[model samples]
Target: MSLTGGSVSVRHPAQHRGRSRLSPQAYLATTGRILRQLLADHRSVAMILVVPSLIITLMYFMFQNAPHRPGAPSPFNNACLIMLGVFPLIVMFLITSITMQRERVSGTLERILTTPLRRLDLLAAYGTAFSIAAAAQATLACVVSYWFLGLYTEGSPVLVFLIAIINAVLGVGLGLLCSAFARTEFQAVQFMPVVIAPQLLLCGIIVPRDLLPDWLQWISNVLPASYALEALQEVGAYPEPTFVAVRDIAVVVGFAVLALCLAAATLRRRTP
Candidate 1:
């Protein structure tokens, strides 16, 4: 097009030309960072990957073959798999404050903020890394729980994958929310025993809500992880179809957005 001064104005293609979108690349890079960090901390890596498996295996041997078998054919196996739903989130919670907050303390956060990259992008990358870390542990546990221990999933493996992803994302969201306000990594780690262990006890993972006291049933219903664990057990082992599935998906999504917003607000507070 010709302008008023007899100058030509050219329009660039809206299609991004040769440039590719960044989500996949960013996610890959983020995954790489997570692996590197995990590798750097050998003991921590052992705790995340090995401990969960050991505990899971111990559960399989002890619970699956117990004298008082569950109502379902694969009661013990189902319970072990249910346990996997809780670990990813707990591990992510323990690590988020350690890694992301440490960046803030070390001035790296300020440097990143000065770049063209978005605050949300940084949040996402870290969150993705944590989610993947949790997912890895969960998947490894599922393999043993299902194939070796005779855990049954009436639903498809694909469905289990979806549920696990949802659980990981929800965990990352909660972890990020905690990270945003936690003053130090020690405090973050300290908070976990209080924050996560109760969920395990109250959430449908360890025990069925119907069997719990009336007051406690309401408590578990309000917890996003509780719904997720129920959904996973349904799609993975037990295969129950109910409103809890849809409700869990909604709760997980809501918590994710809340966590992201909290992280952003915290970052903004730290900004000039």
Candidate 2:
């Protein structure tokens, strides 16, 4: 972006190897770099991640002495599953916004734009990084919850791992779409409420759809979490819940693909 250095020559396709296709290895490498960046960024790691863990802890204490039914199931497992959908939204948004916005302002994104590397690959890298970060955080949270709050699950850890990974990946793809559309870092931050807050309120988290009005229930049904929550709960609380949870996993994969297309469309646009 600096004109004082005279003309800048962008590298051609043959000049670079990793940018041409969406390589999972390349994506994982970029994700490692991004994690190093996060470790260096201690403040962000605390606010977006540590704070949520603290919030969960506080909620547990506040509800500790409450009444319990004779035959009621522990809702914590499913609640954690519900939290997976919304919590990753924040983490993914933070990850994508920080990295992409920095690149955009520093001209790194501009340089990459002229290359053979597809925008989808670029976005996929961010999502990959976020997915890894989310997994680590979820593991930490699960450990803390089990040790301190007596959290237990009747479901398989393998299933939980799958759900967490898919949820994180899908969330990161969504965050990329949000970051791509944002004109500025502040705008990206602003987009969070519009993008994620709705899902938190309506995705069978706070208020169930059946309790809401007919139109509102219909609206909530369209949310990604509507399907995801069912899958998560089925794996946790209601092991025999209707519909195949594996199919919901498929839906999460579909969302990731769809979000990749949105990212591609975003980078493809011209100033006109």
Candidate 3:
């Protein structure tokens, strides 16, 4: 086609095609591939699901003899809540970021992008696959905490399990986002200190937010883990769900969605 006077320009048919809509089949295929890879890696499977439970059990025994007032909150309960909220975040973050970095380095992601796969489909597939593992991990942690460790909760154990899963998913989202910036597995692992350590310090896990300085408290309020820990605490302390508990859950979910969207947007088809 003549553009102006003597210049001829042509548009490729592929360029004319609009953005591909997400396909469930493609998403499931990607998810299944990831799940199969994870299953084959026996070490990863144990690290993702089993190690956290073992750690929680150790904590239970360590705190079993701690002194507590008759009406005061139990140290064991607080430790269990912290384990549920933080353990999955740490494990899932390491797994997702390192796995994604490996894919990027191996040119697998570039090859996948050459196909008709949408970025959102890939991101959702990672999220879904890790979420399944996350759910299993959370379940194991909760069961061991409740049965073996003798964790007593005023609220439903089901609620604790649900919140723990959400927290794990949040880690997956953050891991994906962080992976875009990492060129090596070491860099991905380094993100734990830079991205997650601060949250752990400020998320009321080690020290209660109320006891923190005003500025630190403000920082804590913005961190998603803070809300997760808060929700778990509420569930342990209250017989019925309270408004604060629901609100904290919503905030944690919102953070997870926001992180995932950022991850999809920032993902590159190939490493530079």
Candidate 4:
């Protein structure tokens, strides 16, 4: 309310609202702001940079003493390769979901949406920032796994890194989409089991997806993580990027794009 003489005046919340266009200036500003926030949070930085390597280190010790048969690969190394992809995806998903939820709960997202800023710009800015974090996380993890843990792959490490980065961005997209349905940070956390658990169980990591029932195979076919794991497996089995590996990577990138677009479509100006 504004005082004019002895009277009070009120304005409608939507009075000044208009269709916000995408602006490079606004997008860069938002991206820079979020990047600064991410850097300032030491815990998040550690989680993104340190936790994956630590987990790999622990796995190394856990399987160091296991008996190995002649002419066989280390079980620990095999598991590490799988986890190299899984860890970044899960970690990125958790961080992105909770962080976005916090913005809504704290009214930051609401206030921003009220401005002349397009939803796509906001979501794209968020994607770019988290992707940078994901790249750093994947790089550190790959270094620890390949250099320190002796994790071996038949294919080039560069291809593995490429797949890892794509999976991390996939997580970011899904997390952004899921956050739209959550009312609180806790609710966002709850979505992990709902969104990720099923994929883990059926992503051909535990059991070969093709060996499972027809219905189960069909389900696995639809999950993006299944494609990610398949791509990693192809890399492990081949010395170069094969046609199948390239196809899987493309599928994952498509899914991530779809998820981000849907999230933008569902974005709300305020929490209800």
- Model 4 regions more than 4 Å off: 1-20
For model 2, the stretches where C-alpha displacement exceeds 4 angstroms are 1-29, 74-79, 239-242, 268-272
Displacement of residue 208 (Cα, Å) in model 3 is: 1.7
- Per-model TM-score, in order, reads 0.77, 0.81, 0.93, 0.91
TM-score winner among the candidates? 3
In the range 141-233, model 3's lDDT, one tens digit per residue, is 988888888888899999999998898899999999999998888998999998899999998777889999999999898999999989998
Q: Report how far residue 212 has shifted in candidate 2, in Å.
A: 2.7
- The worst-scoring run of ten residues by lDDT in candidate 1 lies at 13-22
Q: How many backbone collisions does model 3 have?
A: 0
Winner by TM-score between candidate 4 and candidate 1: 4
Q: Output the better candidate (2/3) by lDDT.
A: 3
Candidate rank order under lDDT = 3, 4, 2, 1
**Candidate 4 lDDT over residue span 1-272, tens digit each:** 65666767665656545544767888889999999999999999999999899989999999999888876878886888789889878998999999998898899998888777778789999999999999998899999999988998999999889888888888999899999999988998999999999999999889999899999999999999999998998998899889999999999999999999998998875558
State candidate 4's TM-score: 0.91
Better of 2 and 4 by lDDT: 4
What's the lDDT for residue 186 in model 1? Answer: 76
Residue-level error in angstroms, candidate 1, position 112: 1.5
